[model samples]
Target: MRKRNTLRQGFACPERSTMTVHDAVHARRTIRKFTREAVPEALVKAWIDGARLSPCSANQQPLKYKLLMGDAAAPLLPFLRWAVMIAPQLEPKPEELPPAFVVIAVDTAIRAAGAEIDVGIAAQTIALLAEEQGVASALLSLRSREVPVRDALHLPEQMMPALAIALGHSAMEAEAVPYEDTHKYRLDEDGKLLVPKRSLSEVLL
Candidate 1:
């Protein structure tokens, strides 16, 4: 008999789908509700590899990732504000919280300023890779929550938490629809998230 893949045996490795880049882009959404199923730490780390290879400004590569899972991730939950547009309704319940997260931190010691572009690129890379692996993801900007996050992670003074990407198995479905008067997402009667997106024609010009 052939040897089995040990990584799959030890962790909840969801089979990678045959999702194209375009498909992943179209299917990707900000998932607020996630299943309690534990996300494999190794798998989440692998997504960081994708971000590692992302382009950085002047190759400074100031971005660093901090991985959190299960209990370690719980502390940061209270500080994180989810789905501000929908507030409490879209906030994940205790049972629906993401089991893992990749916090992107900026190493100010290296290149403090002008790292925003690199952060965006790296974040999107992680999100797309997670989506391809049948994992749900939500990219969260720390903003006012930065202090609590840094404190919770015990990050060094030189490292600042810029963004957080929550990862887990999705408990709900969300779809991007053509934009109407307002470009706000809403939940349908079935609890499915309806995200309004501008059409290519409207954006092309």
Candidate 2:
């Protein structure tokens, strides 16, 4: 069935492989640079379908998603402006400022119900699937009072808004700066791409 919230008409996957899924998990990073070319709506739907299968608490399916595309910037863009300005300047580009916007509330259907885990799982599922298909996204969190995107989208009142992931086909490639293993992380060796952590010998008792 076609997803209710997206205009994506059809998925365009030529090579089907779970390795792609794994690669997406390891390779996916927050992408801020996007090409003006709009990703096919159907492809986006296919990713959403993949997300729908994420496991929820008791499979209660507490997630509700809404996608924002094009100039539909009124909902969450202005709030993101503060971050955008401070954000590392994007690499120079020539195309239309790619389809850019927010992933309005990604919330669980119940309040204070610990559904965040389920919601996060679904969001990551969508993101990883996007990466496998050559699309990229940035997961962002912000505080704003300028507008009510929730009501604008007519999302349920019970759904709690989570992270707002800005998505599109990135014009630039992103890298996963390596992070130190939690057990190996330490302050003395901290640097870009080199996360701090404890050695396995030190971690294992």
Candidate 3:
């Protein structure tokens, strides 16, 4: 299972197959600033449906998604910003802030490894679907180990929380661009995507 959740994983959209899931992957980014135009609840619902179709281990189907939209989402911003402060630079600019979020949590005790995997896969699904719907998203990792999100959301005790994906109507005049200089990108001598790779190849294999 992939340790980190990403907007990639080549999950194909077999039904339409029009945009090529790869386009979504390469185009997807953690959109922060968002337009003031609120996202319609209908669009959010579609994203959830898209996530529900994600493949699960043994089809355990252990994942669950609860959406917080409209007025129901206001209280979350304060604590959400607190968790986000750990990476202050990553904060969404005013233009990038999403109005609401589709909080993805899972009951891992039932499915174990599959629960984690399902949560991640579902996240990407929503991300892609958000782009398809002309909305934008940002994958906000839940922090503060002491605070249980399930309790905050009034979810069941068994449901272990995983991710909080903020979604909103967006106006992205700026394109997702690679760094102008490789120095900022942290690449390898071979121009591979490298991030502090080990001197001894890290794996000791």
Candidate 4:
């Protein structure tokens, strides 16, 4: 009798990959203190590619991305607010400024109802992808800076700036700390960035 061919049954084992999606997810931290080291353009493009494939509301994909670097990133710096929770101590210094930025704009011509959700997913996707590339990112809402950002970027009236993500090599460290009565994050005396997260029990209900 002929033996059954296991190869034809598609049972081949795959080689081990460097890092899993879960690794990238869990390792991701909001990095505000970035090194002066410039982020390669190719890495930024890869992050944007990942963001573009993120799940969208009704497949409308209403998000538009604008990549800024060098001089392009400087004009938008004043518009960005960092470490508002800790303000003076946690605010990034001149040398720690991010070397690149991506402005996620919402196209008003598309359905606007779910644009917020779309932007949220896309922004996180970009951040996570950046982590995989050994780059760091800070996702900024750009609320008060929206108008100025629009003017500086020369965004069309039809395009509304939803968020800005700062990216570069990180110069500082951030760690998740246990949650307490107040869920606000603060810096330690040593100046390490600390983030407070809700306890599992507090979130499950």
Candidate 3's TM-score: 0.68
Better of 2 and 3 by lDDT: 3
Q: How do the residues 55-174 of candidate 4 rate in per-residue lDDT, one tens digit apiece?
A: 998899889999998677776777777777877776688887888999899888886555899999999998876776677899986745356677888988777888899988888888
User: Once superposed on the true structure, which residue ranges of model 4 sit more than 4 Å away at CA?
Assistant: 1-17
Could you give me the TM-score of model 1 versus the true structure? Answer: 0.91
Which regions of candidate 1 fall more than 4 Å away from where they truly are? Answer: 1-16, 143-146
| Lowest lDDT block of 10, candidate 1 | 1-10
Against the true structure, what is each candidate's TM-score? Answer: 0.91, 0.67, 0.68, 0.86
Clash totals for all candidate models: 0, 13, 8, 0
Total clashes for model 3: 8
| Residue 67 C-alpha lDDT in model 2 | 64
Residues 1-205 of candidate 2 have per-residue lDDT tens digits of: 1122233235445355444566677777666567776766566666667778878787667666666666664555544432343243442243524474435354434435666677677778878777765667766655642135565545676555665666677665444433454523212322222223344575688
TM-score, candidate 4, is 0.86
Candidate 3 wrong stretches, greater than 4 Å: 1-18, 78-90, 93-96, 112-114, 145-147, 171-205
Q: 42-115, model 3: which lDDT tens digit per residue?
A: 55776788888888788778887878875676545554642233245445565556777887766666665546
lDDT of 1: 0.84
Candidate 4 or 3, higher TM-score = 4
The 0-to-1 C-alpha lDDT of every candidate, in the order given, reads 0.84, 0.56, 0.63, 0.77
RMSD of 1: 3.7
